[model samples]
Target: MTDGILVVGDISARAQAAVTGVVKALEKAFNAKDPIALSEQFALRTSWSNAMGTRLDDRRSIAESAAPAMEGFLCDSYARYDVVKLLEIAPNVIAVSVAQTPTDSSGNPIEGAWGATLYVISEQEEGWKIVAGQNTAVESSSA
Candidate 1:
């Protein structure tokens, strides 16, 4: 999906919807600050790098790292994720680009907290799961 529109291609509508659905699920989980729920969107062997560049090798590790932050320092942090682009690299595989804007609990945007995330998702027996992801903070231009 790009700009709230799915990029038209040879991919099936069902596939597009499913991939988009996964991204929505992630947003939901993040807002809820449920580490377990958040990790559910990923595959068992997922590779994830947080916006701070901390790399986690699997879902368990991801959840483990998220628990304290979600319950402590980042307890009040919220974010909204928009799918900026989706590319079908191969059959049943999609590369998703997401724009993440930090928001308050009331869903109001927080300045200077923007981020971008790239997710590599694939269809598996359990459904669409993110296999790999990298999140990077968007820095303001000095110019």
Candidate 2:
């Protein structure tokens, strides 16, 4: 559905709530460093692939592999998303593009791996959640 306005459009209440839920859930999960909670935002058969060549399909596996990075090596600044746009590609599919950046533990800006995450969400009884995603890292920005 088109909102008629630029970024704001005629989005269904359920869809709007779903999008807001996903965004808030992610922000909280990352800030809390809770991988399990973070995994809940995705469906059981989600796929996460990054530019690092790491390709994983299972939600649990992705969470496990991300533990250390989310906990130690990286600064408290974890995965952050600046949603640029959202579009309903199909009746059951939604595509969202976001500008991602890494921050320090205090949530301060850091110069590191920066890229974009293009996610495709699917409608579920519980609401819309990510079913598949492709992460492209900013090669110029070193982590």
Candidate 3:
């Protein structure tokens, strides 16, 4: 393969990994209900925004945002994430389109899926950190 093509392939691979790893870490964090583990994956200055247009720009605020859903919920009942699309928007920026369907309280698939969550991932010295993101609820799911 040409040097240019080889370089492009490498870049793509790295992007893919960054996107995949970040998504997986999110999933693992929720699945395990391990906030500290989740915190480790994010940068100290991470910013998280909720579906309601609320934004949390600090670690304390981020934890506060995630605490509700994770609290009292069984780790086994968490949802799994599937990446619908992964795009390399910039040299170290990745956009991940992920679909997440919550299972019932008993850890079984719910009658219908909740919705998809879109995430913007950035490469940090520690790892992939979510500097900004937004989520939308899918109300028209046929299930």
Candidate 4:
């Protein structure tokens, strides 16, 4: 990987903005602890792998499971998401990769559990939605 952020292919500013909006929206929903909203960002029949490598089979199950997961760790912490890269794979599809870190709500750093997520977004009648995604925990560099 290069030192600078790598954005491959051509996604116009507007399209890029919209494609990236999915991440922003996910961040907002997670921060707000709105699992329903968060799950709504995904495609109904698709799957997502959480940071723990657990496969979530569908939207309903994701939403069902996310509520408590949010309350458990996320509701008490502040999260930061950085887009590592975005690739335009097709006319109306793009893949986004992100780095995520979080601290306690008080801003105290929590050791470990850093994560990287990849989201494949596709255009829907409503807007862009995550057609597929995977979130995996990253070990500390010194680990």
Candidate 5:
């Protein structure tokens, strides 16, 4: 679906597949606990804001922090990433939102206001790379 965004227009099946692949790569990298490899998935000069508010503004910073930080929180957690929506904003750029639920090893939900991430991916000569991303907490509005 277009998510009611006229700018996205219509996407070809091939384009859709490529975008999906980028999402898959993200999950795979996280599951693998290889931060350096994960950073490679991003553009050389990228911006990433973690759910906890840590900001890595470039590939160098991302590679340095992502792995160490993730090791602590994700070591005993299991989460699945889902591509909630993909908006092709330009000829080679796509904005994506993903839904994820992190649970303990026993499948119990982790205590947190976290649920989704927003990403901007760009198609490079080799493949798609995330040029920017932000992980945020999902706060409830119900009182």
Candidate 6:
């Protein structure tokens, strides 16, 4: 017997592409250590939490908070972001999950520094902007 295909509700491909594009932009900005460009990916009034659990509200706060890290300890660190899942929660709103792997200056993956980030993005007048997000560190299990 032949198996039937499964369908998971209707989601616009255009919207998915746009949302993915925004994430790609963020990854690019982060790799470049450009705080301004990174903040531009978020909405004016946003709720964001970093891996260290620091909460930042609004784009200005996000920029201010990230600038120091980008120029300090994290200066030589880079990361690769991969969109793991995308769900359309509501019209024009998308919930996205991404996996992040920290890497060194030479693109070597850092040990035990993986992270996962969840972002709630909305399609605004300008484009898809992250309205809320939280980044959590993924602990490595020792066998």
User: For model 4, how does the per-residue alpha-carbon lDDT over 1-143 read when each residue is reduced to its tens digit?
Assistant: 23344678877777777777788788778877899999988877677998767788788988988988888865575666667788989987889888877666554557757778898988888778888899877776221
Highest-scoring model, TM-score: 1
Can you write out model 1's per-residue Cα lDDT over 20-81, one digit (the tens) per residue? 88988988888899999899899999999998789999999999999888999778889888
Candidate numbers, best lDDT first, in rank order: 1, 6, 4, 5, 2, 3
lDDT of 2 by residue, 1-143 (tens): 23421234445667755775686687678778888877777777888785566877977887887677677864356656666667777776777776677776666667778877777777877677788888888855431
| Candidate number that wins on TM-score, 3 or 4 | 4
TM-score for each model: 0.90, 0.78, 0.74, 0.85, 0.80, 0.88
Give the clashing residue pairs of candidate 5, or none: 113-138
Q: What is the C-alpha RMSD of each candidate to the true structure, in Å?
A: 2.6, 3.8, 5.5, 3.0, 3.7, 4.6
Error of 6 at 3 (Å): 22
Number of clashing residue pairs in every model?
Answer: 0, 2, 0, 0, 1, 0
Supply candidate 2's per-residue lDDT for 91: 72
Model 3: per-residue Cα lDDT over 1-143, one tens digit each: 22222222234676676667777887788777877666565567866665566877766676766666567534345766767666557778766677777765455666444556767678878777876666565654421
Angstrom error of the Cα, residue 121, model 4: value is: 0.7
Q: Model 3, 93: alpha-carbon shift in Å?
A: 0.5
Candidate 5 C-alpha lDDT tens digits along 19-83: 77777777777777778777888888788998888988998898888777678866655655667
Clashes of 5: 1
Write down the worst ten-residue block by lDDT for model 5: 1-10
Residue pair clashes in candidate 2: 3-9, 3-10
